[model samples]
Target: MYECYLTFRSITPCQQAQRYLTGQSLRSQLLRTPKSIAFKGCGYSLKLNDTAIGLAAAKLRQANISYGSAYRIYSDGRVEELYL
Candidate 1:
């Protein structure tokens, strides 16, 4: 399975983005942003399958919901930043 993490500046937009993605038929999980890449301080993140990454990001943009950054979680436990 592939996983992606999308960080948000705050909890509000993070929750909004998760709800928006759910409405669009993409499944996501709300979780605390990884400490290593948390925005400014600690924050929230939407964890979803890699297959939904592009669509999720696009939909979030279309809905005007802002997010900070994205990262891909490797099976081997490495986390790399994503440009989406």
Candidate 2:
């Protein structure tokens, strides 16, 4: 499985924010695989293709998606954040 790193100032799960992650705005969806990824109560996540990580974050940020950054999370637990 491919992994991505994402940072958030807050992980407190606001209603709208949560919905956004699951919404149709992007083909990506929130990470449901608990062991694979973690999402704080009020934060947002985007699970897109590994290669699209850069473009996804960029386009999302350009669209005003609230997030600190996004990255690739390897099986070894290494995380690489890409700033949008």
- Which of the numbered candidates is closest to the native, going by highest TM-score? 1
RMSD of each: 1.7, 4.7
Ten residues in sequence with the least summed lDDT for candidate 1 = 33-42
TM-score of each: 0.87, 0.53
Clashes of each: 0, 8
Q: List, residue by residue over 19-76, the lDDT tens digit for candidate 1.
A: 9899999999999887767748978999888888878998999999888888987767
> Distance (Å) between predicted and true CA of 46, model 1?
0.1
Misplaced by over 4 Å in model 2 are 5-26, 32-42
Residue 64, candidate 2: alpha-carbon lDDT: 70
Query: Global CA lDDT of candidate 2, please?
Result: 0.52
Cα-based lDDT for every prediction: 0.86, 0.52
